[model samples]
Target chain A: MRRTAPITILALTCTLLISMACAVALGPASISPGSLVTLPNAWMIIWDVRLPRVIAAALVGCALAVAGTAMQGLFRNSMADPYIIGTSSGGALGATLSIVLFAGTGRPVFAFAGAAIATFAVYIIARQGGKIPVETLLLSGVALSMLLSAFLSFLMYTAGRSLHQIMFWLMGGFWNVSWDDVIVAILIPVGCLIIYLYARDINIISLGEEDAIHLGVNVERLKQILLFVSAFLTGIAVSIAGAIGFIGLITPHVMRLIVGPDHRVLFPAAALAGGILLLWSDTLTRTFANDMPVGIITACFGAPFFIYLLRSRMKA
Target chain B: MKPVEVIGIDVSYGAKKVLEAISLHVERGEILGIIGPNGAGKTTLVKAMSRIVSPENGTVYLNDQNLDSFSFREMAQQVAVVPQGISISFDYTVRDIVMMGRHPYIERLSSGTSRDLEICDRAMQLANVTHLAGSSVNAISGGERQRALIARALAQEPKILLLDEATSNLDISHRIEILNIIRSLTGKITVISVFHDLNLAAYYCDRLIMLKDRRVYAVGPPEDILTTETIRAVFGIDTFIRHHPFTMRPYVLPVYESPAALGSARRVHVVCGGGTGSDLLYALHREGFQVSAGVLNIFDTDYATAAALKIPCVTEAPFAAISPGARKDLGRCIDATSAVVVTAMPIGQGNIENLRILEDFQDKPVILLGDGGNPSFQDCTGGEADAIVRGLLDRGAVTAERIEEVLRVLHGAA
Candidate 1:
């Protein structure tokens, strides 16, 4: 268990690094070797535009995956994802309102607040008596996600002027990612580190709440901290990448199958794999069809993958 | 010294009260067993002791300090619990699961040290799961899983270990295996376990606390707490209690129900002695006959069985001759019952009066079990007891070769 993780993380980091280099060099109007030797234009585009977008995608991916891992641990369900329980839609709704009202200055703050509130709302509604059964929480999240998404759709329909910006944001892309965005998005790794600090507790919590408590975890406080951190991660990711789907849901699951459920190993591996997965999807969409949203590619793949997971888990 | 003390704790789920005003104390390093029928709050009481559920009105003290004052880590370091059933979806290895018991001691962000791993290794060896350490916990059988959970608790090395039906899912051998593991830990760590099997609880637990209707029904050594009266009262079943010859512990055997009910109105009197009449009484009771037994010596095994079944019995003082007042009571019982059955008890000087009562019941339906040996074989009065039994058999008494035939004769008379 000890030796397996560092090697896996090292391998993933190397793959992520290699993927980033290839991705940065291969956008629309690919930088030629001769141009790389001759002019500052290629250098400027690679440093300014491509690096920030890749870095944004990587950060958002890492954040979403870590948040998804935390949420899965919190709910103790294998199929739990960030967006499955309405966190993404909540963040989107908050950002959309900010885009229209505060003109995007408070988008990150509002998005974080919105995601946190939605998570708690679903949690509060699902809790019966004293226990929140996994099935009840899953159903409640699905219902609330639909309800919130419907409200978001209504808001988008009414906003005639900001429809394009809302559509682009909702489609989920890193087209306008800037240094300020990167600074706000740095919370993804910082939040992941905080989650890592509680990784052992989360591992026990994933077994069951009663098991966690009897094992010496203050379950209520651990839950609050994990939920807050995960929601904060989704909020920050949504502020930059606009509800990129599936990296959070699939990354941890894939890592768990490979590395097992030891959170000490699972969390870091998930973060790296998530970064690589999103960076690959972002590079593919930009290279093949520059106008296409990264969310489209992710959802196109994620929805089917999620259905497969649901079906297989049901059979299990 | 008391390691755990529960004081008037009340626990309820929502509006339904599971346990009310329950109190108990556990001596250090003693194996205390908790037993009750379904829905009797056995699990709730254990939870309260471990501080998993805070009581609405009472407090739990650990080593004379309030349980609420301890942080979760400190509480876990002192008390380890192996819950009834745990389902794991995330495929954690058995070693990974067992290592979780060391969570309270290991600081955050740092894995277990060499000493912690050594303790975990020894714990696995103690639980006999060292071979299964690397296997997925979900892939094992129920008994293996139970052992793994026990190994986890052992890894914790707490002062107290609480088990809630920990062996319920296991098979007979595994049940004994887990119980034996607990039995070995008796003097080293305090154990409070809930057992559904009364026999196992009686065998393994040093002290047993029987619960009924959300209250402490009885609490003492297993021999005292596991009496026939307590079993019948708490479990609502007729059970015979006997001392295990090897361990000297009380063992309970439930009286099996009869094949079919003859009629509730048919009443029968049994003339039995020694241990021969106990089975007949159980058979008659199961067949729905209102049964009574008599003139049995106080120390007779049949008398104890009769008492356990709560049958109205006429009794004589042990090793003494039957009194006239007891004989009068036996006469009334004979007049009231529709028929009488006699078991093959050894005829003795003290119980010879029991044979004389047969002469009066010759006109009635008396089912007598015939053993070929004469009553004089056990008689101190020479051939007189044999002659009396022979006369009773000739005077229109029905002969039965087996106890089931006695039940048949009663049903026939009914």
Candidate 2:
């Protein structure tokens, strides 16, 4: 109950809206606000090309952040995120399988199934008795991620013609997004809302599973619901964009410092900040870097920040 | 109906059994304490009652209903548990932690109401943590954090509260303060707590269930359960149980004795009275000496110590001088022993015979225990007792200052 939580959430929300407008307007073929009105080609560029891409990027970012925040709370480890826990890798492999076998017909469904299975696998592997120790959970996630990546790599190797599409998807960008993808991304808000309803339970559970139980949280069921929802969100993000990495890892952590870890405030704040972050990252790559994969820029910044977190946590 | 009843519950972790066929019941508003040595399954029993661990073979009943029939929220509304301690991963404020106690009542769609906040504030006040409401749980001290947890448990407004050694980690003042708060909750909230400190359990609990080797060893009021014999049998230590001066509750004082040293089977008679010889008697007995003390009146403090240690004593009646029968018994005790040790006790008319009898055993090695200075024999019999001591000293009676030195001299003489 920090006094500044509402203010922080409101401020991040406004910032995210502004960032989304700038991202939609400032693409490679920059359409000015005046041109959007008079020029039909400019209007088509804005409507068909840039608008859906920017909207999907923002929604995917929100999904990843909400999933990450829930994960950090569920594991009671600040370092946990959808990407770190093999959810994204599982989604990547699932998408790659659909691309190789069915020509990407029902990719989101396959991705979601894969993500859910991987998350539950990691959970079962890490659990000892009734508790999941943080170290075991992290190590199990790493092991599962490696195995999923291997499957993804094998799928890419056998597909000669669709290899380029798989490679581009794996690198993660919104260059080919459309209105249909935007329609699918609408599910992100529904997932976020469902998770938001359990924000208080997440706050109690982060204290520890046993304390959560004492406080009337159904700890095992809560863990299952959170993991399923996080996998759902991660699966959708991967299906729309690609296996984007650190928006899930870094945004929730930084927002926690500002909004002070009440998941009610933290979930919204992290979601908004994550949307702003990925919107700007996508904007930067498409505008200046000749539409390179946005995941490269994010990882370049995310890996170093992750190392800093590790070092600081070690000192603590 | 009892507020809580367990019907021969057995709990196990994997293949290891923690509690075996443990059955108990709690009255409506009494504080029932569970106490035992480590690994005696005290905490596991609490866990079973709280539904943190389901019993493998038996059922727990709350308000005459099977425990498993209630949902997690319903069970929490009925029973609140205060664990020993917890490390919060997030920086939740004390108020935030306490407000979580109202979760079972609050619907998922709505936040805590003004009434919930009122209960939180009242709970904080009762736990003496009102001033710390806004502080982060991580920033507070351990004792303060423990109190905040108590505040959280209080805010639950539960019908039955289970505490697993909740005050065991705090200091004496904090322990008493928190227990006092819980004690004030009696007649409204039924409490079942696990206690490591037997004295606190005795002082705070209305009744106690003592566990030994995973079974219910004894259950009664503290005065009846915390006896010298029961404590000796359960804890395997000698305890001097007495009523507290103010509360009249049983107070346990452990008679700290090291293991008996090997190869010393010699007998030493301690000539002590007026509580001077208690420590010496304990030390000698711990050192494997077949020690005996007396010609002591039945009411002497040393006589009590001797009795507690199970040392053979030649006792006289209270406030009585040494009788002929006691004197003859004392002579027999000294003759059977290898050495005599005279502690610094007052030489009154009633006990001067304790020193006079020392003369007959002159050839036996005699050791005088002094107060690290001169052996001040408080001779109320004037020069007569002093002359007898002087005669013993003239006949090579050695004087030692402390118990260690007395033990050394006795061992050397042996």
Candidate 3:
């Protein structure tokens, strides 16, 4: 039992830095490895362009994984990924609405605003007083996701000339990766990770509200904070990258199946696993496809395995 | 004033009034037992007492203070309840659940203190479930789970303990162990427990509360509370009540059916089951003939009724399974008796040899009830049963309808 977590974090940190370096330095017209370090134009491509995008992927992956682990503990159900319950639905709707309504004016900012508003709306509608039953939250998230998707479709139908562009973005991508977008992704996810360290409180909570109250936890206050922070983190990430689906849902689940149910181990394990998974996914999308969006790549690769999980779970 | 008193408390679930303005008292250091039939509101009474369900009318008090004045947390601190539904949906460990009981005591912004842990540990030790301290509560045996729940309430460190049918699911040994534990807790605390088993209530409780028709029917010592008349009236069952030789406590024996129901029986001596004695006697009586049943306790419902009907009944004190003395006495009864009938009562390792009495009077008739098609006789046979029962039947014994038909044949021969 050589101190499991610090070593795990160190391993993840090494993987992340290696991926960042590769994301910047590898391509068809590869910048010379030596020139890449010194040449102003080459450094701009490596540092200003690819570096931000790689950082954004790593941050968003970390945020979703944290949210996934927290949601799992909060619901006390293995299946409760952040994307499962309308959190992603709210994020997608907000981003779609912001793009359709405020296009060419302020892309990331309005999309983020829209994401926050959608999350708040979903939370208010789904919660009964202060308590949100896990079942209701999942159902509402799915229901609202469909409703939001329909609304996005309606926006696409009316936008005419911009329809193709909106559709393309909605398919999801890291193609528009830039330094500013990277900063947006980094700031919000980092803030959410700070909030997610509070996920330990959820370990005691998921047992029951009454049980949590007895354990000297302010159960209501903890629920409010977890809900807001997860929503806030997911909203900002989706605002930048559209709805990249299974990295959050599948990564945390696989990590849990590997490491066991304890969230203290699960939270960081899922974050690390989610980051690596998306990094590899982004690499595969960029290198293998014809300018393929990251979301399509994830669904194409992750969905078949996800479907197999559902089938096996149903059999069990 | 009593430390705790109920003044005309009533509880109703929807339109059904389960408890009707019931009043009671619990002085400090009293081990009170509540005994009743299945739907007699035993649980309703305990729940109302604990304030788990608020009574529709009347008041409950602790130390002359009205129960309404106390919040749930305050009441929890004063009179902790180990509720009947001890199961949890989540897979929390025993220590985790016990620690939850210390809720009313834990300091602000901290986990439990050393004092809290010590209290929980003491509770587990007292309940004799210390081995299960780290085990998942959902996965443990029912007895272990019940002990854990009790440990939780004990950890609450309340002055009064309220348990509702808490020992019902346990085995005989566990039941006695739990009852003794409850009885011992009365040194400084008041313990109120509802029990379905009357004999257990007799052995352990200091005072017994008998309920009928949503009201208190009797309240006293077990000897006073467990009269045959009360059992007949409250439970609609005829019973024989006697004093135990040692404890001198009232012992209740439920009336079992007789062998008189059979139209004809060569008097079959059922060395018999614990309860099979009743069916044999009933079968013998219903045949409109006299057959003796004996060496059974007067508190053995079958034995008492046989005595009442002048069936030459023999008796002994309330004991377990069958002892060697009981076996020899049955032999004496068999020497004078005719054929035998083995009722379909459970024939396990304890009393399996008891049924072999027909094998000895090898020439005598032996009828085993529940042998053929009847479902009641299902427990009578096993792997070697065909040979065992067939051997007895071969010696001129057979199956009869409730043992009465066998006796009619004996009467006809007479």
Q: What is the TM-score of chain A alone in each candidate?
A: 0.96, 0.97, 0.86
2 or 3, greater by TM-score = 2
Docking quality tier of model 3: incorrect
What TM-score does prediction 3 earn? 0.66
Candidates ranked by lDDT, best first? 2, 1, 3
lDDT (CA) per prediction: 0.87, 0.90, 0.70
Candidate 3 C-alpha lDDT tens digits along A186-258: 6665655565566446655665554454334566677667766777777767776777777767876786565
DockQ of 1: 0.69
Q: Tens-digit lDDT track for model 3 on B1-414?
A: 676899999888889889996998977888889998888888878767666567989998988999878755577777777655543534566877777678667544556679888998998888888888878787898888888878887888888888788888889988888777777788777888898889988988889999998899999988899987898889987677767779988888776643335454344454443566665565556554546664455456566556644566545566555567767777777776665556666555445546655466676655556644241433444644446666765665656664456555555446
Best by TM-score: 2
Off by over 4 Å in 3: A1-33, A102-144, A161-173, A177-201, A208-229, A246-248, A251-260, A287-291, A297-316, B1-124, B127-142, B145-170, B177-303, B306-402, B406-414
Backbone clashes under 3 angstroms, per model: 0, 0, 40
lDDT of 2 by residue, A162-218 (tens): 999899767898889999999989999999999999999999999888888888899
Using Cα atoms, each model's DockQ against the true complex is: 0.69, 0.85, 0.07
Candidate 2 clashes between residue pairs 3 or more apart in a chain or in different chains: none
Order of models, best TM-score first:
2, 1, 3
Give me the displacement of residue A231 in model 1, in angstroms: 1.2
Which of candidates 2 and 3 is the stronger one according to DockQ? 2
